[model samples]
Target: MALIRFVLQSVVEILVLPVTILSYIGIWDPLYKRFFPYLMVKITSAINDKLGKIKKELFDKLPDFASSSGLSILEVGCGSGANFQYYPWGCKVICTDPNPNFERFLKKSIAQNEHVKIARFIVASGEDLSQVASGSVDAVVCTLVLCTVQDIDMVVKEALRVLRPGGAFFFIEHVVADKTTWLHFFQHVIQPAWRYFGDGCCVTRDTWKNLEKANFSELNLKHIIAPFKWSLISCHIIGYGIK
Candidate 1:
């Protein structure tokens, strides 16, 4: 019975492999973006609510040293600008993404937030944010973006270069799981196909390790599972750090 089940699964994966590859190459990303932005807002709003609760639970005792007044912030890979709503009032956020399609959405989203009127939207790649002056930003935010960038090291270096000394780098991302043997095996097997379908999102990169190797300080790590799953294979991770 197990052999038959395994064979069926393999066959299904093989059949979907080509579609996945093409999707990762961004063949369907436009279609996805059209419908995805609305759905993403709803879904991420819920996720952010939960994250708020979890953050309070985890860091309530820690000193809230981050500035509460207007501060210059940059968000790398701010897809559709969904996170703009989560920023504190009086923050001057600059949202940047390589995708030109995101510009319209980012502008609209920022317009809705009175406190975020100082926000700016830029169409730029993470690798070349050097166009923004160094040591000018008070904080840098990246969410679910590092996995898709062509060069993670360069992105981190650029983030470090732009951040002021003692400023924080905030991030929330899903990363490769490191738990059970079966989970690891499945991740290894599906990674190629997953990346092809998910726009270069690698499910096996240990982002925390990568950030540490980049020498970012005050690392804080946490893991959270997505609200839904199929056969324990679909889980998520969240990591944050400071510089």
Candidate 2:
């Protein structure tokens, strides 16, 4: 079984190489934009069903805004707004992303998620969110975004800076697996190609460790194997912390 897994992984990598190259050249942007959301709806929905109570337990507890209206959430990388439906009721969301290709999907998501109001759509990278005021939002929600940022530290710092005291940073991101495992070795080997094709994603990134280094206390965090048919990049952590 292990040998078969290795063979399958190798075959998939070989097939994605050319596609990854095109992605690095900017040709894959529109294609990814068009397909990623659909893939996510299928993937994240299953994840929700499996994670049932866990998802609601955390999101329901997010800090409320000063106006008592709702939680003020600033989502970094807000990809196609895949997590929009899960947002708490009456939450005010500030969406930020570097990719202009996601604008249409985001607008559509905003329209669909009537519970969460769209406050603004900032065309900015996570590392530099100058348009968003510091110590303003009640929470910073980041899902599957830490892996792709050029500077994870800078981006995390900005998240901490913008969050009000006692605000939370909610995250769900895949991370590097056990160092001695076959999967870890495979990830290390294919990281360069993976990032190129995956829009700067690092499947081997120890994102939870990086998050620990940030200026916040850990509230809840644990790793779970992602429930995808293709599980190579499936090891992920889901949790949040107060700022």
Error of 2 at 95 (Å): 0.4
Q: Cα deviation in Å at residue 150, candidate 1? A: 1.6
* Per-model root-mean-square deviation over C-alphas: 4.3, 3.8
The estimated TM-scores of all candidates read 0.75, 0.81
The lDDT per prediction is 0.67, 0.79
User: What are the per-residue Cα lDDT tens digits for candidate 1 across 102-139?
Assistant: 66666777778776645567778888896788977877
lDDT of 2 by residue, 1-243 (tens): 557656766777787778767776988877775666666556566766765566666566664433355578999998777777778777888999987667877788788889888998888999999999999898898887998899888998999999888788888888998987878877876765666556678898888877787778756788888666556677889888777
Per-model clash counts, in order, read 1, 0
- Lowest summed lDDT across 10 adjacent residues in model 2 is found at 61-70
- On the 0 to 100 scale, the lDDT of residue 203 in model 2 is 90
